[model samples]
Target: MKTVLITGCSSGFGLETAGYFLKQGWKVIATMRTPREDLLPRSEHLRLLALDVTDAESIHHAVEAAGPIDALVNNAGIGLLSAIEGTSMDLARDIFNTNTFGTMALCKAFIPQFRQRKSGVIINVTSTVTLKPIPLLAVYTASKAAVNAFTESLALELAPFNIRVGLVLPGLAPSTDFGKNAASRMQNVFPEPYEAFAANFFANAKNTAVVTYAADVAHAVWQAVNDPSAPMRIPAGADAVALAAQSL
Candidate 1:
C-alpha cells in the first residue's frame, strides 16, 4: 500500500485529511506538534508522530521516523491577523517560520527520496488570501504566497524526476480553529489607529455566508495526489473557487 505523510494533524485540515486518507486505506503517517491517538480512529494503517515543523531538528527527526512515503502534505501552519503597523518583526518571522520555511524545509527533506524513487506528490496547503488580498493579513498572505510561488517553480524543477508538486488554496474555513488560533497570535496587534477597521473586518468575517470546510481541502489533496493531470493550483472551497475566477 502507498504511504503518505501529513503535517499538522492536530486539528483543522490536517486532522480531516488524515481521516480521509485512512478511510481510503492508505498508510498514513500523521504528524503534529504533539501526537494524539484519540483524534483519529484506531487503524493499523495509521501512525502518529510528534512534529514541530519550525525546528530543523524536529523536522529532521520526523522525516527520519516517517520512512519512505508516496506523498507529502504540508498542511501544517499558523495564522496571524494584524495591521502591518502593529505587526512586530519577530511575529512576522514566526509566521513565516511555520507557514513558509517549514513547508520549504519539509520539501527539501523529501525531494531526494521522491527523486530517487522517481514517483511522489507534494501538496502544499496555502490560503486563498493570496488571491484576494485584504487588510490585517499582509504577513499571513505573504507567507502563503511565497509557498504558492515556490510550489509553481518547484513543480517545473521536479517534473523531470516524476515528482508532482501542486498547491491547494483553501478559502476562509470558519469551522476550523483558524480564526481562534489567529486570535491568539493577534494579542495587542491592533493598534489604536487600526482597531476600528479591525473590528469591522472581523464582524464582516463572522457574517460571511460562504466558507471552506476541512473536507473540501481533504478532497483537493486527494485529487492532487491521485490525479497525475491535476493542475498546479486547485482552489478547495466555493469562495476560493470564486476568488480564483475573479483573480483570473
Candidate 2:
C-alpha cells in the first residue's frame, strides 16, 4: 500500500483528504497541532501525529516517523483577511512562518527520501488568490504565490528523480473552518475605514458557487497524485476554475 503523509489534518482540507485517502486503501499519516479527542475518524490505515508546520523539530520528527512515504501533501495553512497596511507585522510574519516557510521546509526535509526511492509525489495546496489580486488579503495571497513558484521550480528539479511536484488552487472553499480560524488568529482590532471595507468585501465574496467544498480539493489532490500526467497546477473548486480561466 502507498503511504501518504498529510499535514494539518485536524480539520478542513487536511482532515477530509486524510479520510478519503484512508478509504481508498492507502496508509495515511495525518498530522496536526492540538488534535481533538473527538475528531478521530475510524480507520485502520490512519496514523495521527502532532505537527506544527512552523517548527523544524516537529516536521523533522514527523518525517522520521513516516518512513518511505509515497506522497506528501502540504495541505496545512493559515489564512488572514486583513489589509496589508492594517495587518500587524507580527501577524503577517506568523502566517508566513506557517504557510510559506513551513511548507517549503517540509518539502526540503522529505525530498531526499523521494529522490532516493525514485518515486513519490508532493502536492502543495495553495489558493486561487494568486490568479486574482484580491483587495484585502495581500499577505495571504503572497504566501500562496510563493508556494506556486516553489511548485514550479521543484517540479523541474525533481523530475529527474521521478518525483512530481504539483499545487492545488482552492478558490473560495467556505465549507472549511478557514473563516473561524482566521477570525481567531486576527486579534489586530481593525480601525476606521478599513473595518467598513472588510465588511463590504465579505458581503461581496459570499456565494455558494464561489465556495468550493473540501472534498473537491481532496479529489483534485487524488488526481494529481495518481494520474500519469497531472498538470503542475490543479485548479480545484468552481470559483478557482473560473479564476484560472480568466488568466488565459
The stretch of ten residues in a row with the least summed lDDT in candidate 1 is 178-187
lDDT tens digits, residue span 1-248, model 1: 99999999999999999999999989999999989989999999999999999999999999899999999999999998898998899999999999999999999999999999899999999999999869889999999999999999999999999999999999999999887877878889988988899989989998999989999999999999999988889999999999999999
Q: Summarize candidate 2's per-residue lDDT along 1-248 as a digit string, tens digits.
A: 99899998888898888888888899988889876646657677878888889988988888787878999999999998887767888898988999999999999999999899899899999998899888888889999899999889999999999999999888787778988889986666365768888888788878445668898898998999899688788888887888899987
TM-score of each predicted structure versus truth: 0.99, 0.96
Q: Which regions of candidate 1 are displaced past 4 Å?
A: none
> What's model 1's lDDT at 236?
96
Deviation in Å, model 1, residue 157 alpha carbon: 0.6
